[model samples]
Target: MKDSDSPRRRWWHVDPGGALGGLLLAVLSATPSLLPRAALFQGLITAVAFAVGYGVGTAAWLGIRRLVPMRSRPILWIAYGVLWLVAVGALSVLAVAWQNEVRRAVEMPPLDAVDLAGFLLGFLPVVVILIAVGKLNRRVFRALQRMSGTPVALLGTLTALIAGIAATVLVVMFGVDAVYKGLNGAPDAEAVEPSSEFRSAGAGSAIRWEDLGRHGSAFIGGGPTASEITALTGVEAKDPIRVYAGLESAETPEARAQLVVDELERTGAFDRSVLVVATTTGSGWLEAQTVDAIEYLHAGDTAIAAMQYAYTPSWVSFLFDPDAPVESARALFDAVEERWSRLPADDRPELIVYGLSLGAHGGQAVFDGLGDLRSRADGAMFVGSPNGSALWRTLQGARDPGSPVWQPVLADGREVRWISRAGDESLLPGPWSEPRVLYLQHATDPVTWLTPELIWSPPEWLDPSQRADDVSPEMRWIPVVTAVQVGIDMLGGEAVPARHGHNFGDVVTTGWREVAGDAGLDQAAVDRIQEEIEGYAPIQPYLE
Candidate 1:
């Protein structure tokens, strides 16, 4: 080691080990999420990113070492803090500009005090983690150094970098993968086994032996059967029903859509109340809460239909089922649209579209834009939408001029309303008539806001107190760190209480009531419907 005891030649020296330490720790912590994509490209991308951070951190440390006395811990820490501030200021502006570009807005947003606070808050955790990891790295290096017959500087640095990278891959392959496999829980039991045809829609319709899906998920009753419609909702309404047909790697897309349409005809659902055509993710799972809301609001007169596109869980679908969502949505919509258009206009039931998460992305795939949506469907509700959803992104770009991109008001809230909370329906100033839509997005849903730009820039939503009130103040936007934090946030997004986090729950009752645009939803009546929804156990049966 270059001696601090030496005079006149104490030039700033970069410790490659310390510089790369944080990157290694980050990969270690993020192994769980990254393990899903075990590919050469993923590893190369991660390694390149780590190398960049290593170079930047090395430069920062060397610069600080020259200016501050190494012996003075107080001054050194102060310098480190200032360096972080400088890093944030320089990087955050680029982030804001990128988000503006993504939003298709030309206006330049100036860096405010909140931006500074956000970066620093985000940086604090990162620094603590990196420092802790760096110390561990040193311990490992020292252990290696002791084992060596004679210390060699170049070999030691090379060994440490290699060890860090190897550790990352190893953790992903073993530790993270093992945990994910364990958490994958049991696959669909054979009991809820899927089938191609629809069964009877009578009251007290327990999932019979034949009712099991191809994938083993039972088609839990979305609404009471035809006989119970009067007793359950106290109205002469058609029984609400859902037929979820699971698609396997074994089946083609065409057959799946055909089976779904056939199920509609078999159960006599096409001739019933409002027909909702929804898209499911890999698991072919649908949110029961939203179905319950519609069933309650429509007084059991709704037919909610979703066909599973895959047998895998939604997270796995995200990594592997990028095209399955669009494919399934198109097939289902085309089949339903063809059938709906054939029927006389007045005689036909209203057609609507719905989805969430990957399902939401799939829902976006069926339409050209909001105009096409208006022409095709009576109403639609896409909840907890992903940031990359094409339709949602297009609407965001065409929103009201003065409204913030985060909460854009499309067409002055004429056809659509973006509601965060349950009663946020009150936020709408005017009435929504035909082609009504409601985009249910929680203010702090990382699934809806987190993007690739988070790597270098703080997202607009992460700025200051701009996030929803339920979000923690410490959930600030730090380069790289915020990305990891939010990645974890997505896993538990639905764990919070109702009306908060990514859990939309029965609030969708308000969404459906508004989207229906009928005076059928009286304040007192809707309140009772909401209570009925709550009485149904496990409000959110399937979390996206």
Candidate 2:
């Protein structure tokens, strides 16, 4: 057999062109992203970027080889190896510097020697394993191709590629389905029974406490008491009513929504000065701050109704069961609206819709247009709305030309407005209209901006002219790499400080006051409310 055909030589072969491409992207992957990433996450991003880069480089090289046949030399390989080592070593140091820059910008701790050690520990094995897998797959395909003449060989390779992809897709689908089922059925270890008289199923008329899933129970039982609010605001307050229905409470969305409405009716929720229809995240989790803010702003003269849609977290529900939120939000809103509309317009509570993250996506799905929105609800506040939201996209696409994409001015903020931080609502110099729709989205929020388009084209937010205040200036868009980085960023989006990433934090107080109409809150009162809510610890998701 010839040297090229030798098994040992084939097994050991490394493509110089591919290595160069991988190195280029691996270095670029270390640049600043939408959020600050730790050593482990950075390593994962680098490895994945390297793998993708290697594929692109390999494909390009193959195309070149087809056009002009050339053989590699030993001396050239030696020189290339030395150059590769120098480039990698130098770029790695730069990568660490870039990471530190991001950390400083985000007010996070700088990476140390231990972090570098951790990065290496996380990166090497993953890259090696990925390369090995790719080589093995290629070897199998080549072996099949070699079994017959040219025409048959081509057909065999095509057949193998199709079969492999189909098998992979099927395996992934089944595995993911099983995982979802397991998660849905799993009991929450942190779940505790409700003791609050104001909460659903807590010494109440109908819904059982046990039937309220972990998040459902937490939503109903948590938040400030009327006395707590009164103390903070220096005003008398009534107990805030919270009604929720878990997945186990009813089988279908319609049933659960009906149950929610029934609970609201029994609790005299419609009689309250302010009523909020809160669409919950995937695990039926409501942002404690979002609900608490409205209750405080209304001096506990508020009732919030929500229901569970899926058992998984927001991200999982986003990818797997995207329709659950849409379906559940529509059902709950329609049911509540039906009942509320039947009551005397002068006597009933002012209706408002609220949602965050996946909840926002679902809540926005309920409205067909601005007309539909104004016709149904008094006002709407959607925080960290996902890019996939059609209503959000429509409003944003038609935003005033001069306004930045991060926080667009829709119709000069006459009806719809977007805010990243407090006081943004007043930034737009236009007449404020009734039935206001406010989008509370941080400029750095991956949940609000990350999309498949990012894999190919640069988003307008990444443009220097349109970049947000919180986002690092060093952040640049790279095809595929930026997409992966931002996708990973979503995992820890809410872990950062308020007004950054996906964490809306205490800004919801201002947001609630703006959308729901401030009862009598002055700037001082709003500040006190923010301080009060800030003291409350974030509720941990039971499934998480």
Candidate 3:
């Protein structure tokens, strides 16, 4: 109060109330997202801030008059303000950094403009509430001010500081623990160990499940009968394993598939197996057009699964046995076999499944469909999937009976080997196909941010028609368009509609690669596959 009161005299005020007000403000600010009445809360918070300033100022003035020898008062108060400001700045940085790291580890989507705006607005009330608390606690401020010159003041300050430090430490520790248990969806780190028996043909890296969560492909029915699996690889075709990867767009799968095919061909694996590119252009709104184009390069079929694409629960209806995961899985296998039986021998291909986000969950459905295909035909691959949400609940100890992870499954009639990547926070009722899983991951991928318990509620306002169109100016620059188009062409220009964003390319690559060895895919074979992917459209976007 004195600092603003007179220019002639060096003066200062120590408002113990300011500290209290600040504490209250911080607590309130921390809950911006949960606030029920934004406008009312903000006004009350601001009012409290002003009151805290007034109380702290008045208390400081009176305490100086009652105790401080006249001249030294201003200097002490100035020092107090400086120290507080530094402390506040340091705390702010810590909070922001922690939030960012937590977000990344759990596979949460990047913050949008709305999230940023909310953050900015959220802090005002916090500061105001803290200031208000300080203002109301006049007696507390006066007590501290009276002892300003004595060792008592130091002791009092130390006590307050200690309490604050303890509270801060507790908050941080609790936040981290909560996030670790709830948001970090990965299995216990101790649970993951290296496997020596399973090996990817060309990957120089160690296989880890976390990496599989980030990247892996599950193949569905094998390529179309018209396509020559033998031509793609010099080896005679054994079983046609179809591939599927579910993502918002098909770009990731297409790119990874081409890379895998090329690598396999160069390594001579293709000489033994034929690995043709294929895509599953789901018959959802956004999928049809994209799949039709993708068809030219990647061989794929467009299958519409009704509204289940948007309402994940609808997968229950498609399951072989809605009441039991194991039974459902077996039923799915029967359906696949039944379908294969009907197809002219040459038209039927083996099936594998791959997915990411929603697609990953859908992969679980495929596994359910072809329960024991590995023993009968080939294997499966799954990537970037959350176990409960997308992959139905089929594994042991399933918490959600309707979990998507179990949807694509077959009965345990035979063993199926699976390849996966790390940073996939997907939780399952149990481990993957026993004794046959390989996982991989990159250290920097943000998908690591996900925890099993963390739930992401998509905004209900998103309109299906507003989805980005390949020809739209906004989407023209996106590389994924070309990849999706590859899948679309595979489906003869049919497209899956979109309510939820789906990535077809990611599904294709991951699924096919898992069963690649069985097909004997290799480098030269991949080049031919790449040519087909590039040949789909009249103009090659990759060339540009």
Candidate 4:
């Protein structure tokens, strides 16, 4: 072949093999993930998948070229291009059908013509821009290599790469730190003095209202009132004790935990029938469903204590200050456990632990393992736990042979029971044990499934035979594409309707009842409390 016609001579242009690979993977990216994705998000996933596939294909082609001459007739190349286009069109149609199947499974509206247009419009520009950027970076690296002498070319390239990475890291670090500080320092509109002495930071409380921060104030102010609980349960109820220590409440985690214990004592929480150590999400947000359900179930004779560790949202904390939740949860639990342990075992109120999402991950960190968790608290309820939690992973891995990963049955459900919906507890066999640990996880919740391993391997939840009923049967796992799609799914996981994705909703009432082993709560009472909780508006709306 002439030099102009040689494949090596056209290295600057988009290689046919790479483009073909990119198209194939990009099309496959449209397949259903853990949750139904928005058109724009799907487009982004497709663009990312294309970039990854193109890189892999380019490398493979380069390797093959070294072993054999890359030569093809003009007609053969044209025919291959035509076949690729046909494949793309065929796969695109399948992609739409698969997405609609996922939507139907989740009770979401099907994708229409506008969605298709949106996906195409979103995908084309992003993919083209990413390709352009990749080419520009490659050209810049090549130019740098050429400028250096042949003897020092490798060293020059290494130095440039290191410098570029270091500069990027520094910029990101400074930018993130600035954003964190701004958020942490901003004044909360809801942090006002409470009129009732029953609440933390209220009339007679030592903790200041201004120190409660946004989420802390909301948590302290929210939940069913004594009258509301009495009306719903038809039994006179005591005012539920809610104690919180915000980030500004004390300087350190230890101090904050101690303050919470003090506030709990001041509110006579220990005298209540149930005392709960409720771990807060990154912004110190507590799920109303979890706490309210337990309170109403016990006829408002409950005390719930929580503390803030980070000012940012859970995702931000997961990325930047991953250890914050764990540390805070450990401190608060240890303090409460110590204080509760000192009281007369026969007279002391039942100690329970509760958390949702990142809060669940944090709450699990308080114990060494399953044995420790069982021994420490009377019962524990962790909702939408992230896959990274060690205790959760251990229990899940130790699940009985026949159980599914989405709703694992641990040890015949003697101690640990995984609840996906309202009546999942009924599916458990054998006698129920004290200190029951319940994990409330939806099959389609990406937060509970997304992990780094997803980039290379399929999770047990994707096993064909053991898949949960809520997950679409058509959903197939594709290595890197699956990881990206699921990660994106986490962004809007909680926005979906209750019982799907990360929104556990009122199903938590069942989880609380099972974990608490409240025999007094019949189906009617549970339904009433759930209904009341569902209708009640939150003092502050915060995402899990």
Off by over 4 Å in 4: 1-15, 55-73, 151-154, 180-193, 451-457, 517-523, 534-543
lDDT, model 2, position 403: 91
- Positional deviation of residue 532's Cα in model 2 after best superposition, in angstroms: 3.5
Can you give the TM-score per candidate against the true fold? Answer: 0.66, 0.89, 0.32, 0.88
Tens-digit per-residue lDDT, 116-209, candidate 3: 3565465455545554454445445555767676788768776896898899987975664344224222322433322211122113322223
What does the lDDT read for residue 500 in candidate 4?
87
Off by over 4 Å in 1: 1-216, 220-223, 226-232, 404-406, 517-522, 535-544
Tens-digit per-residue lDDT, 1-544, candidate 4: 8975554664447766678778778877877787787787677778877887787777686666565444745666788779887988887788789889988888889999999887888788887787777767776766777887585777967887999899999899668656754654333565455667678888778888777766777777777788988888877788889998888888999999999999888889999888999888877788777788888898888889999887776887788889999999999999999999999989998999988889999999989998999988999999999999999888888888988889888778888888888777788658978988888989999889999999999888989877987789988878887887887788888766777888877588788777775537667777788887666553332344
Local error of candidate 1 at residue 339 (angstroms): 1.4
- Model 3 stretches astray by more than 4 angstroms: 1-84, 92-307, 311-337, 343-347, 365-377, 387-511, 516-544
Candidate 4 backbone overlaps, count:
0
Q: What do the candidate models score in CA lDDT, each in turn?
A: 0.61, 0.82, 0.32, 0.81
Ranking by lDDT: 2, 4, 1, 3
Determine which window of 10 residues in candidate 3 has minimal summed lDDT: 304-313
Question: Which number leads on lDDT?
Answer: 2
Candidate 2, pairs of clashing residues: none
For model 4 the TM-score comes to 0.88
* Candidate 1 lDDT over residue span 207-289, tens digit each: 23333333324443334455554454455655565755554322766766776676677677777668888886446666666
